[model samples]
Target: MKQLLFVLAFVATGLFASSQGAVKKYRVGIFASLYLDSTFTGSTYKFTNQMPKHILPGLDFVQGALMAVDSVNSNQPLEVMVYDLRSADQSLDKLRSRNTFDSLDLMIGSVSGAEYRTLADLALLKNIPFVSATFPNDGGVTNNPFTIIVNSTLPAHCEAIYNFIMRSNPTANLVYVRRKGTQEDRLASYFAKYNKGSNGSTLLKWKTLNLNDNFTQTDLIPHLDSLKTNVLICGSLDEAFGLNLVNVAQKIYKTYPMELVGMPTWDGMKDLTKPEYKDLSLFYTATFFNTGTVAATNFTKGFTDLTNGRPSDVAYRGYELTRFFIQLLLRYNTQLMQHLNERTYRSFTEFDFRPVLNSTSGKPDYFENKRIYILKRSNNLVSRMN
Candidate 1:
C-alpha cells in the first residue's frame, strides 16, 4: 500500500518545514487519472519496464510539475500532492469526502469527462482554484467560479477559425468541408452563427460540402476553385476525415489551388508533416504554443535527460501551467483569481483569462483563457501565423 501510494508523487517542498510561524506555506494538488490499479497485483507493484499507454499523459504531467516545483527558487514551503483519480483507495469522490481538497490551495488536472466534473465540484465546494489543464469542454460544469479552463473550448476554436479566415480572405472562395456526424452538426451550427449575424445579414457566404467516410478526390474537387485559391476549412475534428480532406486537396492543389485549414485538434498531429502532405500549406488554431525560448530549450533538454526521450507538447504545457500558477499562488495568496489577467508571469504562451458569465444570473460561470494562436504548417515545419 505504501509502494502504491508512492506511485502518486508526494512532491517535497524544498527544505524542511520551517520552524518559524511567520512563513506562509502553500500546497497544490496535481490530479490526474493515472490508472495504478492495472499494475497493483495483490500488494505487489509490477510493470517495472513499460508504462501503459493511458498512463503516459498523467505521468508526463506529474514529471513536468515536478520539474516546475524543483525549479522554484523560493524558501516558501510549497508542497505538491499528486492524486491518482483511478486509485482504488484514493478516488476523486472518496478523497473529496475525506476532506482532502480542503488541505490544498490549488488543483491542476489533466483529466476530462466525469473526472473533470468531479474536480470542478470539489473546487467549488472547497473554494480552491481548479485548473482544467487539457480538457477542452467544460464537462457541463456551470456556476463554478473556481474552475479555470486552460484549453479553449470548441466554440472558442470555431470563433478563432472564423476570425482567421475572415481576416485573411473574406472574399476568397471559402468552402466548409465536413463529415456526417453529430459533432459535425454542432460545428456546422457554430460556423453558421458566425455567418448569420444578429442583424439578419450574412457577413460571409460559404458552401458546405458533406462527405462520407469513404470520400475521395471526386467528392472534394467539385466545391474547390481552379482559377484562385480555394480556401477549404475542415469542420470535423475526426483525424481520418481531416487527413482525407488534406490528401484530396493535395492531389489537385496545383490546378485548383487550395489553402487548407483544419480544426484545433490538428495542432499536434504528426501526420500532417508526412512527405506526401508537404508543399501544401495547412493552418490551425491552438490555445498553447511552445515559443522554444531559452527556458523552453532547457526544459526540453532536461526532460530528455530525465526520461531518456523527448517530452510531448503536453509535458511542456504541464511545466508552464504549473510554474505560472504556483508562482501566482505564492505571490497573490488568496487573491490569485483577482490577478489572473496579469500578464506578468509569462510562460510558453500568454494567457488571457476572462470571466465567463451566466446569461441570466450575470455571474461568473468560470474563467477561461481566451488567447488562441493561429499557426501554419508548410514545408514540413510549423510556425505561428501573423
Candidate 2:
C-alpha cells in the first residue's frame, strides 16, 4: 500500500544555504502522486474542486504541507511546487527528465519498491536528504547517507517488542505465535537476534507456537501458562492473522493472564474498539502517535478550517515533518543533515533518525527512525506504552 509514494520533494538550489541568522529565497517542491487520470473520464482538463477517493491520501498530505508552508513565519520566498505523479504534464518520468527536482535539498516521501529505489538513487546522486515518510522497509538501498526512512522497520519493531517483553518477569512464558508465511520467518529471525547471547541462558523462556489460519482457542491455550503471565507476540504482518489471533486470545485471555503483542501493521486496524478486543490488552508498535498537545490542537483547527474535514494521520505527519525540517533549513540550511539529531526543532511526535551503516565502508548506509512506540488498547481505549 505504501508503494507509489506521493512524494513531496522540497527543494532549494545548489547548497540551499543560509547563515545562522540570515535567510534567502528558496524553492520547495511538493512531489505528490494524485493519480489524476483516474479522476475524470475522456480527454478533459476540467475538474471539480471536490476530491475523488483515489487522491485523498495524497491530497490530505499536500494540504497539510501547504498549511505548514503558510504556517512558517518567514518573509523569505519559499516557493511551493506541487507535482501529480499520474499527470501527463508532471508524471514521475516526465518530471525527472525535465530536471524539476534535480537540485532538491530534501525530499519527504512514503515511496517504496522500484519507485523508492529510483528516488533514493536520485537523492544519493544529488546529495538530497530523501525523507521516506511511511515506507517501513528500506527496499535494500545502502551506502547513501542522504536517505532517511521515517518509519521504524520490522527489526526495529521486533526489538521494541523484545525490550518491552524483557520488562516483564524473566520467568514469563514468551510465545512467538504466527502463521505459516515467508515474512514470519523474518520476524522469528529478528526476535532471535535479541534472544541470542543475552540475559544469561533462557531466563525469558522463549518458545514458538505456530498456528494455522483456522486456529482455535485450543491451538493457543495449550502453550500458555496459568502461573506465569503469557506474553504472546503475534509474529505476523498479516492483518487477517492478527485479527484471527486476537479473536482466539480474547476468548481465553481471562484464564491465561495474557498480554498480546502485535506486529506494526496492527497499528492500522483502527476498529479494535469492538467488544472482542476490550477484555484483551492488545499491544502494537507505531512511529507516530499524538496524545494531543496545544500545537496539535492548533493544527487540527487550522486544517478543519482549510479543508472542512478532519485531517488524516498522514496529513499530521506532513505538517509535523515539513514544519520541523523547514525550521532546520532556516537554522542550519545546507547543514540540515549534519545536525539531524538537533533538539532545537521538536515535532508533535518524537523522531529519532539514527544512522544505519554500510558493512563494507562502515559509513552511514542511510538513516532510520529507530524510535518505536509500543501502544496498548484496552476497554475501547488506546494509550502509548513506551
Which number leads on lDDT?
A: 1
What's each prediction's clash count?
Answer: 0, 3
Give all candidates' CA lDDT scores.
Answer: 0.82, 0.75
Kindly list the per-residue Cα lDDT of model 2 for residues 40-103, writing each as its tens digit.
Answer: 3543333455555766787777777766877787655465566566568776577689896765
- Output the number of the TM-score-best candidate: 1
Q: How close is every model to the real structure, measured as TM-score? A: 0.92, 0.89
Error of 2 at 224 (Å): 1.5
Q: Report clash pairs, candidate 1.
A: none
Task: State residue 176's C-alpha deviation in candidate 1, in Å.
Answer: 0.8
